[model samples]
Target chain A: MLEAIILTVITAATPLLLAATGELVVEKSGVLNLGVEGMMVMGAVAGFAVTVSTGSPLLGIVGGAVAGVLTSLIFAFVTLTLVANQVASGLALTLFGLGLSGLMGESFVGQPGIKLQSLDIPGLTTLPFVGKILFGQDILVYLSFAAVFGVAWFLNRTRAGLILRAVGDNHASAHALGYSVIGVRYVAVMFGGAMAGLGGAYLSVAYTPLWVENMTAGRGWIALALVVFASWMPWRAAIGAYLFGAVTVLQFHAQALGIGFPSQFLAMLPYLATVIVLVAISGNRRATLFNTPSSLGKSFVPDR
Target chain B: MMRLELVKRAEKSRLMSVLSPVFAVALTVVFAGIVFAAQGHNPLSGIWYFFLEPVTSLWGVEQLITKATPLIIIALGLSVCYLSNNWNIGAEGQLTIGAIVGSIPPILFPDFVNPLVLPLMLLMAMAGGALFALIPAKLKTSFGTNEILTSLMLVYCSNLFLDWMVRGPWRSPQGYNFPITIDFHEWAVLNAVDVGGIYLNLSAPIALVLVVILAVVMRSTLKGFEIRVLGQSPRAGSFAGFSNRRMTAFAFALSGALAGLAGMMVVMSEIGKLQPVISPGYGFTAIIVAFLGRLNPVGILIAGLVIASSYLGGEAIQTSLQMSSKLATVIQGVLLFFVLAADTLILYKVRLVTGREGEGARA
Candidate 1:
């Protein structure tokens, strides 16, 4: 029972970890893409549709990532090139993604989905709790951990990452230093989009193994909050995602246990927890300012 | 590969500012046509059903007005919030809470059948919305929380609360197991005015009055100037003695009140009773309305009608073309993207540069 619960929590946390990690990079690059939810939903629908058509969950995941990249490019063009308000453009991207995905997935509703299978090593498959907990998970679960460590390394140890961070911190300075601010931001935004897509694909192909309109159901927004709770650190985001996943799983368990409270109220736990967590994290003015990218969410236009 | 570059203008272009929305609508229509064609339908017929057929009949026009009323009211309040630089994205929650609070007089005190019940309900709803909105405002002022996330989070909480209410304590005895409340008494309902054989709800005129009042306030009041100054530059606003904290609270409360009023109107005029769900995403849709209207009261009113028609058109296509009503949401989203993109033309000139010449110049 304990191992089963842990596995469920990991499954739940993987998507959040995936998305929050991507958003952390985007914010570190000084671009706030509010459309994580949009890209995510698009990925979910596209991933599900492709999986259904191709009978391969692997291709579906890739299709979802590509869909996210394509969606993020629209945002890139509007904000990075046209220099539109990043906040509004992000909101537009979200609304567009939600609507477009719903329309696209209209036919896929109520269809039985093919779940992504878990990995099985020859000898490790029959091992007790620890082995199953660590080695018996699906491919995306492993990828999520790899992504966190990869992002942590990329942000701290890489020269290109330093350039990306520099652009986010002070675009004008980075521009004067001969780095392409818009180019770096575009890559960051697209990366964020791809990660969000992967997260969404996991929802449709692994977590629930079904296509539902707005299946993301505010997870994208929660991922956004996770970035803040982590103070923009990749590893911290992983911890935050797992904590939220625990809360979510515990709530479901409580509902199953018939604790007598209304299920609706129980359902409110994650969202309420998010608000409380945000207050606690952002309440520290010095800490928040210490880590937040100076140029985050501000539009950049390079002058020749 | 060709790349797009923007060069800032010395001053905002008046012509482009006025024409941006028009250009956005045109662009959305064209893209919508392509979407329809891609789905194995005639693009022209899809356009006709999606945009034109909804407003051709008197009944259709009534439905348009009915839908536009709440959107206009909600957008008007949002304009104030946006203009003051307060991002109140949780108007949907405010609306839900407003509907609940407004329904109290009717559901709890069904025996109270005086004209005063309606007015009192409206006031209670506005107060409910304002107070609910102040949650994020207070958090921002005290804890310095990000209002956007807090506000949005509250939406889910409020929605769940509403669902709990209808399914539990507030469920009507006579609702036949449906998750709904009892029918509201006549005094609690908003009546329609018959204007020469055409019936229009009282909420329509109320929305219009609000638009006019807000237009005047935004145009001439010192408060309006304060909102504008703060939004443009918080430094200048502080230097000029306008309090950012107070402005945040004020903007949120005002928008919340308006959203509450719209919610009350929706319950009183349309639904006529409380239910598990009261709105069809009107609060969020109003955000699109607020932007498409350029954050102006009169412009919002017009934009509200345009969007409301889309809702009708979505239904029309659902029946005529067998398309999902979600197509309306797609069109609205596309329209917003174009609006944001086109507004760029107001302040900058976009030029397409071919080849490495532009890249070399930048380097």
Candidate 2:
């Protein structure tokens, strides 16, 4: 029972973790892409469609990442190149992604997806309670952990990460220092998009192993809120993702346990928790300023 | 070796401000053609069918009006929020709660028929939406939480709440296990100006009145001036004796109230009963409407109609050309994307310069 619950939590948390980790870097670089949901759905469709057609989940995951990058490029071009409002452009990206994916997934609507199978370690699978939880999980689950560690390490220790944070903290200052603000932002946004895509791919290929319209179903938005909920820290974000994943899976458990509360209300736990967490943490000015990017959702243009 | 750069203008270009959305519309039509052609349809005809034919017919025009009514009403309120720099993207949730709250009158008082039923429903709906709006507003004002994220997250909560209400408690005895409430009687339904299978309801005129009132408010009133100033510079507004915290709550409440009324209109004027899904994402779509109208109430009236017509256009092509109904959504997204991108042209001009030549000249 314990292992099973942990499995559900990890599976549920992986997508949120993957998406939020990418967005953390994007936010660290000081660009708020509200369209993570859109890019993610686009990735979901692209990954699913590719997997369905090519009969390879590996290629499908690749397809999902590439699709996310392409979708983010639109956001990058509008917000970075044309210097449009990030909030509005990001909203547009979400709206477009949902619609385009629906249109593209027309043929694949009812088809079954190729599930991304779990890893096979020779001795790990035969071990007792700890085996599956630690080592017998899918590649994506391990990737989620790698992403958290990699991002936390990159943000605090690396020079490139420092430059990314510097650019996010103050674009004008970063420009004065001769770092390519646009270039760094472009790369960051694209990376954010790719991660978001992988998150979506996992949703279709591994989580449900099916093609459904709006499959991401506001997970992207939850992931966005999770970033704020975590104060944009990678480790905290992973924990938040797991907590949220537990909340999401709780709906099914409530139905099974015959909890008196309506299942729909139970299903609303994650979103409500996000709002509550955001409201709760918002009072900490020090945390807000220290961890939150100052230039988030603000448009930056080089004056020189 | 020509390089392109965007130069900021001293003043926003008057002509570009007007032409910006037009350019966006034009760009959307062209890209829409590419999308349709990619889907194995004739590009030009698809454009005409998708963009033009919807507005060309009387039925189409009426359908456009029906869809635009709630959108205009909602966008009018969002215009207020946008002008005041308060982001309340959870209009969908407000709409849902409004529908649920508005249904209370006719749902409970099925046999209590009175002349005041519809008006009471409208009042309750607007109030419920405002109350829901206040959640995020209060959070922002009191705790300094981000309204955009909070309000949007609340939308999901409201949606689930509505789903639960309709499915668990409010589910009609005769609903046969379906997650829908009982249908509203005549007292609850908004009387329509029905002609040729088209509905011209009181919602349109009510929306029109709001447009006029808000347009004037934005143009002349001191409160309106405060909202504009607050949006442009919070520091300046603070110096001018305006409190942003109060304004934040006020803007959200005002917008939320309008969103509530819009939600009531959807139920009273169209659906006539509460269900699991009350809105077709009108709250989010209204954001696009607010922006396309440039956040002007009067402009929202026109912009809402165009977007509503595009919705009809999606349906039009779906039936006529067998295209997917999602086309309208795609076009709306494309339209918003371009509209935002075009907004840059108002404050900046694109110029081409030779990069190496400039370096050589400097040398």
Query: Of the candidates shown, which would achieve the greatest lDDT relative to the real structure?
Result: 1
lDDT of 2 at B181: 87
**Candidate 1 clashes between residue pairs 3 or more apart in a chain or in different chains:** none
Candidate 2 wrong stretches, greater than 4 Å: A125-127, B1-3, B194-199, B352-363
Reference-based TM-score, model 1: 0.99
Which window of 10 residues has the lowest lDDT sum in candidate 2 chain A?
A260-269
Enumerate the candidates' DockQ scores in order. Answer: 0.87, 0.72
Clash pairs detected, candidate 2: none
- Model 2 scores what on Cα lDDT? 0.89
What tens digits encode model 2's per-residue C-alpha lDDT throughout B1-363?
A: 775568899999999999998898899888989988988999999988877888887777877888898999899888888888898899998888877887888888789788899899889988898889999999988898888888988898898998888887788999898888898888888887877667688888898899999989889999999999999999999999999988988888777888888888888777778887878889999999999999988778989998998888888798989988888898899999989999999999976768886456434
lDDT of 1 by residue, A1-304 (tens): 9989998899989999999999999999999999999999999999999999999999999999999999999999999988888888888888899999999998999999999999866688678887887788888888898999999999999999899999999999999999989999999999999999999999999999899999998999999999999999999999999999999999999999999889998999999999999999988989999999999999999898
Candidate 2 local lDDT, residue B257: 82
The chain A TM-scores for the candidates, taken one by one, are: 0.98, 0.97
> Residue B7 lDDT in model 2?
86
TM-score of chain B of each: 0.98, 0.95
Q: List, residue by residue over A152-212, the lDDT tens digit for candidate 2.
A: 9999999999999999999999989888888899999999999999999999888987878
